[model samples]
Target: MHVATADQHTADWLMRFGLVRSEEHLNHYRRQGFAWMVARMFPNAGLEELCAFTDLNTLLFLLDDYLDHQESSASPENRDKKVKAMIDGFIRVLRQPKYGEQSGNPVFVALAELWQRMKKMSSRSWQRDFIQSIVAIFTAAIWQHENVKAGKWPLLADYMEQRQYLGAANIATDTIAVVDKIRLPRKMYEHPLLQELTALCRNTVCWANDLFSLSKEIAHGDYHNLVVLLSHEENISMEEAIVRACEIHDDQVKQFMRLCRYLPNEGPVMKMELHRYVEGLKNIMRANIDWSDYETSRYQYEYEEHVRTHKVREHYLMEAAV
Candidate 1:
């Protein structure tokens, strides 16, 4: 959300395009344009709905500022070219004949495609933010679908958000099969054909976990104690622990696949797959000393001490205020 002084050339172009009538209008246009792009790309969901579903109101606000900065700072010619490219891509998707047939599902498919295109146009930080945001959206969709299927609408308001509910339901009902078939803890992760797929999934999950951890930290103004306990016992940095987790996930998948090739393809493949993966996971757990009782207990104690100190500080502050 940093801004640079506008160069004369860029300022002239903005004047010509009438993009910035004044500094006050910059944020307004940026939000409007971004909202337009989102709506045009994902016609099924409004700005508020998308923000709610992804829980990304903060990020969207940041992105609005970012776009305004880019518009003000970047060269006029470059800005025009980039805008044209975005418009052209949008038009191409919209004007395509037999869109529904080509995409199978127009709403999600088109938005996913447009997201990838826009991601390329954004800065590196923005690209990462976009990926994280999409992952959040996808996760929310999955959660909603499961809630509906369970027939226990925990909150009636969740069900009222039709696009998110339906979109999540569709992904869960359709895409879950493909994901489930991949068989975690199976040897599939090690297989040449499936290695890339497994790696992609592990990376995606890790990214999601990182974001989840960040949110937890921000909410509590403190790091999660469980993670601290794990890190201390593992004798590794948090980043290293995350990497190891990803590695372990990939390894478990590979081992599972190796086990699968041995099993007879007679009865339930999923049942057999789980059995093999669980056996491999047991082996992995045994190999990691951090998973042992003594070290884990020590770390847990340390984490509790850390949390207790924070609680004591808060108690003293409240007493002083009173």
Candidate 2:
């Protein structure tokens, strides 16, 4: 739960790139304290590691919001195209870490910087894995958009399967190795126990997020949430859905605890790395809950007021066009 001193510096860097435009935008970004969350998740990161990871997390928060807003507002035909372009841009920069240097898009520029820094310290195998996790996130985003456009409500099982990637939990977990420069043996990294633990960690954080952010998503006309889906699928009240969601989240936490208590012996160094990695995952779960409950104003936003303002802007634009 320790916060990095470099959190403000990361926010300032984002502001410099014109990401935080108005006072409202700045307030929105700062209130979430995304960098603070990053710091907690990687509590042992060195100053340089902390700064780089914080920058990545902060930029991602903005990118996720941008994609969600665009997908929700744009015509179905045009929506996928924009998200696909973003995915391609990310892949291109990942393939050639310097490719973003020539681009004018701020997203690409920031991504390239992150890629360059990450590539310097991480092995090629690690980089490839990280890229795969990121691509999975984009793919899941497109899937969510498709579901929304089709007015589809995914079954609870299906949503849980894809939610791990969509929540970007894999990407955040992968950073455990990157920030600490701890590379586990290939076999150890791929062990079933480790894989299960990772999934448990992802589910715990994401479901808790689904619970905390349910109100905000409902206000935004977004149903790609566990509580909403649970409510729809079970034909239950929102209160009942929330209780069910919490039960599921608690189950995951219990499993994570059970797995942590029985980790196999992978020799001393490998065992230590495994412990640290899982600990980082635990930290992320804790940080998410703490930040969502106390540090963020995101879920407390005046949704109706925002909708009214948006309508006013639309009408003003229509009048000007006429």
Report lDDT per candidate. Answer: 0.34, 0.76
Overall local distance difference test of candidate 2: 0.76
- Pairing residues by index, what is the TM-score of model 2? 0.88
Winning model by TM-score: 2
Off by over 4 Å in 1: 1-192, 195-212, 215-322
For 177-217, candidate 2 gives per-residue lDDT tens digits of 87866768778878999999989888888887787677789
Model 1 TM-score, 2 decimals: 0.21
C-alpha displacement of 133 in model 1, angstroms?
A: 14
* CA lDDT, candidate 2, residue 10: 76
**Model 2: CA > 4 A from native:** 1-4, 301-322
TM-score of every prediction relative to native: 0.21, 0.88
| lDDT by residue (tens digit), candidate 1, 170-204 | 22111212222325433433455343333323332
